[model samples]
Target: MTDQRPQYGELATPEEQRRAAGLPPLGEIPPVPPMMQLSAPEPVAQAPNPGRSRPVDRFVTIGLLAYGLVNVVITGLSYLDLPTVMNESMKILGIDGEFSNFAQGKLWGTIAAALLVIGWALTAALAIKRLRRGKVAWWVPLVGAVVTMAVVSACIAVPMFNDPAFMAYLEQMSGG
Candidate 1:
């Protein structure tokens, strides 16, 4: 014999329970409306292959990383040559002089090189993290370069301004 107990949902009303028990309706009780249709809501639109390839963002991020690599190498090479650094630092200051503090100037160059390397590494790491998370990361390298170079510029400035020649030139210009 078929079991009369409710087979499924616990929300069965008294009438449903009774119907499951196969009792005739007492005094014309209205039939329970058919259970509401429950289909899954339309699936959220997702980016194509969210678990797979995100090629465009990856390409741009890598390209930007390559650009940063080139810049860091060129800047490091420039800082390696002391004569060029001496001339260029003065040139940047608009002064016809060389830094007498060769050791101190080289120290600044070293600091700049370190900053460039560190900045490149950090940008690469951040970009890789973003790419893995499927985020746009093309701008990280550019922003990293801008921030690192600003600090490097300040580092270069300290020795430049501390030089007697640079200070004299500034005094000469300011009429002090």
Candidate 2:
């Protein structure tokens, strides 16, 4: 209504203001180039399906857990007889040294031994199940368990073996 130039907000519509300003009227923005066209969308690779474990495999896992529990109990018992356990271990391993009460923390040492036995049992159960399922190489868990058990035993046994006192005790027990 006024002779003065209308500022931006004073215009009835942006298009009217743009036109009055001697600028091109605003129109719908031209469609953007489709993202797919601009650049090939990296083909989304679907995640791979991890196959389910067979029933036997599940049973084996349970068995392993049981074995592990057993080992834990054994290790706990071992702590109640630390000196004897250490000396016996050393003798079994044929290690020639005296490991005193001050040498190691009995609890952790025993736990390590227990866990080894349990881990082995679980591995063996898994292997046997696999074998029964017609897996060609069946001895996997058995061998693993055996080796683990031996290593765990040796870890505790070596020190016992090395102790002369332990050996003397063994001899006396055998009535030698």
Per-model TM-score versus the true fold: 0.64, 0.38
Clashes of 1: 0
lDDT of 1 by residue, 1-176 (tens): 98787554477877776777787656576655453234335655443542357677678779989988998999877866544676776788688777776777788878888888998999899988877667777788889888888988887777777788888898999999
Q: Mind sharing the TM-score for model 2?
A: 0.38
Regions more than 4 Å wrong, model 2: 1-54, 76-81, 84-111, 114-141, 169-176
lDDT scores of the candidates, listed in order? 0.77, 0.59
lDDT of 2 by residue, 65-101 (tens): 5665576567646755576666566668664655564
